[model samples]
Target chain A: GAGVSQSPSNKVTEKGKDVELRCDPISGHTALYWYRQSLGQGLEFLIYFQGNSAPDKSGLPSDRFSAERTGGSVSTLTIQRTQQEDSAVYLCASSPGINYGYTFGSGTRLTVV
Target chain B: SQELEQSPQSLIVQEGKNLTINCTSSKTLYGLYWYKQKYGEGLIFLMMLQKGGEEKSHEKITAKLDEKKQQSSLHITASQPSHAGIYLCGAVGSNYKLTFGKGTLLTVNP
Candidate 1:
């Protein structure tokens, strides 16, 4: 793709239901990142993937949150047992490397009721 | 923990006016990036600064990294209505994690 692409631009789900967000990074991008943005808040780092290496999950808020990158191109973020606090815009970004600026996707606005 | 603090949580300026936003870090930064986000839109990368005392300009926006490498400032020259958005500053820490500051919302009134 020309830029990072995210699926389900908006999602509204009941609390306790699981939700999945997908990201298709720019072609040939070796670095991918996931972030969450709550209302009036800054971007919160969630996870990072670099090539075929083990993802840096240090930023994941809890065990319920996990992500995986398949074939080093597309990634999926799954939030199990969603909580109201999980309602936010989930953003995905990709870069050539950690030293470069990232190109972000439009993001998926998740709302838990 | 490394953190970035942005000043002037919000600003309202008239079109054609100039404004500056600052981002300070608790730890030395190896790289600083500036991004803008309009309402309901994705972030738009503005500039990236790596070296201390480095400055870069694009169109009407300019960004500078302090000599100490712990601070950065973004300056907008002749602001326009199209520039109304939230400006965020992000920095890469020694751990290789990118942290961002709560953005400064800029509203340029025409």
Candidate 2:
């Protein structure tokens, strides 16, 4: 891809329903990250994946939030039994490696109504 | 606490004026990057700072990093209406995660 691409640019789901956001990072970047932007919480790191290493899930706020990168290319972020507080813009970014700046996707605006 | 803090939550300036936005970190930063986001658009990377006393500029924008103080600043020279947007600063944390500030919104009135 020419740049990082995210799917379902906007979403509105029931409070208890589940939602999945997808990200396709720039080809061969090797590193992918997930972040969330909310009204009052600002922007926060959600998770990160580096090559074949176990993802760093330390930033995931809860068990309801989980992400996985398959084939070291595309990634998906899943939120279960979504809460209103979970409503936010979910952003994905990719970089060549550590210490490198990121190329971010436009993001998926999830609104848990 | 937010590891990164951006000052002047929002600013309004006249066209052709100069303005600066600041980012501060409570802990030492290994690297600092600046980005701009327009309404409904993804962030656009502006510049990155890695060393103390390092400064970089692009066109009418300049960025400076004070590694010792864990701070960075972005200055727009002769601001234009096209420069209106939200400016954010991000850093690589000890754990290797990239964290960002809430952002500073700038509006240039033509």
Give the top-scoring candidate (TM-score). 1
TM-scores for chain A over all candidates: 0.96, 0.94
Model 2 lDDT vs. the true structure?
0.90
Alpha-carbon runs more than 4 Å astray in model 1: none
Q: What CAPRI class is candidate 1?
A: high
RMSD (CA, Å), candidate 2 to true, equals: 1.6
Worst 10 residues of 1 chain A by lDDT: A50-59
lDDT for A97 in candidate 1 is: 83
TM-score of each: 0.97, 0.94
Write model 2 residue lDDT over A1-113, tens digit each, in one string.
99999999999999999999999999999999998988655678888999746468888999999888899999999999999999889999999976788999999999998
Q: Candidate 1's error at A72, in angstroms?
A: 0.7
**Model 2 bad stretches (over 4 Å):** B67-69
A1-113 per-residue lDDT for model 1 (tens digits): 89999999999999999999999999999988999999988899998888756457888999999999989899999999999999999999999987899899999999999
